[model samples]
Target chain A: MELYIGGISQGKLTYVCNKKNISKDSDLICDGAGCTMEELLSKPFVNHFHLFIGRLLKEGGAIVTDGAIAPDGPKTDSDRHFLLKPGHAPDPEKIANVLAKDLIAENPSVVIICNEVGCGIVPVDRTDRLYRETVGRCLCRLAEYSQVVERIVCGLGMRLK
Target chain B: MIILITGGSGSGKSEYAENLAVKLGKRDLLYIATMIPRDGESMQRVARHQKRRKSEGFHTLECHTDLKRLPVHGFPTVLLECMSNLLANEMFSEEGIIKTRGNIPVVEEILEGIAYLDRLCEHVIIVSNEVFSDNGSPYAETAGYIKLLGEINCRIAGLASCVYEVVCGIPVCQKGSGIL
Candidate 1:
């Protein structure tokens, strides 16, 4: 599996397409956004991991997102980590072992793209902080098993592996 | 060669800079740690960083603010751990005063610091943060902080031989390659 990561609008998808020589073929595209966990795990491309987490938060236990930003919502102590890992996202170990294992086995060249959102100050909201940590952990998990981990900046790809 | 390595938090900019310095430094290798740990979180953070660079054979000189603390000679190569903290230390007074709340003065001080480093070492590698790649305006003070970091990044990048922005632990070159 090849990991292509950067901030939003850093040309990750275009770089992947050009590098993979994948042109004019929607058949190769696997829409992973908003898919059920089973479906998303089955697909080759896992897009919108952040949104997936959001959807999971709304659907799961111990995760109550009054949403990403809440200026008027009353603050509460319920925001702190109730468990070691929030129930919002899928079990990272399972995802790494099951989905990631399957991906590496079946797909010869899988392009994993994610935006870098952990740069700024830690968010005031618990959900936002959890979201940032989740994405970061997910990326690290994926990169560990990936053959190539590339970070794109200003349309330049660096082979970090 | 002067190199600027920048990225988002947890993006491995420091690690990349260390690798490059290890690959290049043959003489007096200096690791300029700019962090001043004043709290538990910060002490833990600095400890983690120190652990990572433990076996990398670095002579860490904690120059929290003043760049002149670095030696003027003998150090062939110096890797400045980060610029963000240095800016905060220099821009803010101990009485909770903030100097150069504007961009020009902060940028000038940063550039002057860089020039000092340039003269001190034969080669310098600076690790900075990518502060402009975020959404929405932060609080006014934070927004001002980000603006200062962005300005310093631009001018120093223009002066460096190579500029790398590491995203997700990968180093992507943005300017001239330091390696021949």
Candidate 2:
């Protein structure tokens, strides 16, 4: 099952799940706040979790960090690491790869939280357009892999599975 | 064979289609319905449709948007109940309005998808509403959307092996050489 946490706002993750009566055992939280990954991992039942911190992290299962940082880190070379900076979109294939790896390795009940950035008029700015397109493609990929999918609107959940 | 049954609002398109589907005596009758209950009236409409389909014993699939994910294979007969709601869904969906620039694509993607259904299924029946007959409304967006629907209807008619326009619960064959 795939739960898509959307909207420009944050902190609705726990509230929405509680409202739906869905347990938080295998939840995978991905958000802009660099701290969400750590918080989710703190839960006793969470088997594995990942975060895409734009900056390099010395530790983590899969590190999607800034490319400008030096290659030397505590992480092994083959530990599903990515270096993508802020204001830049990660490659769809690479994101899909990480998701696939996590699905196989972690094998936890997964929920993904992402920003809803494509509900309005097209942005006149190129960067904004590119970001929206990238996010859209990423969501599509997630949907392809997901057994069930939902989109939250006005804090109400609509199942699109 | 691909057949399209279309009519204006309150013209009983759903009723006619359901009766035809039951008469066909096919178990794999796929009903691709597109309606969201955003208000009391819409909710009532949905309940009414549900009751009608339940009485008819037709298998239904609710697709509010994202027609790209529609299963193309394994169904004997597919009935896409309406296209207007699908268009509205694409209009209001995430990044939908922006992607279409408020103008629904007049190109062949929609037609191509329908053709794909043709190749995948033994029989395909599409249901649509006739919105062009009424010229009273002055809303530019509504008018533009109707024009687009007209274009889409024309295209579907061109490709459809049978085209029937339902008026007052009567089916009138408008195109192709077959009867339904």
Q: Which candidate is the best by DockQ?
A: 1
lDDT of 1 by residue, B1-180 (tens): 689999765566777888888888965678998877875445656776788777887788887665755564677889998888887777764521254343446667668878988987778999998667566364786777778888888888889999988765556778995473
TM-score for candidate 1: 0.69
Give one digit per residue, the lDDT tens place, for model 2 in B151-177. Answer: 888888888888876543345577876
TM-score of each: 0.69, 0.49
**Pairs with steric clashes in candidate 1:** none
Candidate 1, A1-161: lDDT as tens digits: 67877777878777777877875243454533455554444555655555554544443422223322222222444532322234333232232234344445555365676777777755666556555645654566567778988778888897778
lDDT of model 2, residue B75: 78
TM-score of chain A of 2: 0.49
Instruction: Write out the backbone clash pairs for model 2.
Output: A118-B95
Q: What is candidate 2's lDDT per residue for A1-161, written digit by digit as tens?
A: 35454454444455456755765443433333343443432322221121232222324234434322222332555443332334343343344344444443343345555554443333444434434433444454555566755555566665555
CA lDDT, candidate 2, residue B58: 68
Return the lDDT, model 2, position A36. Answer: 40
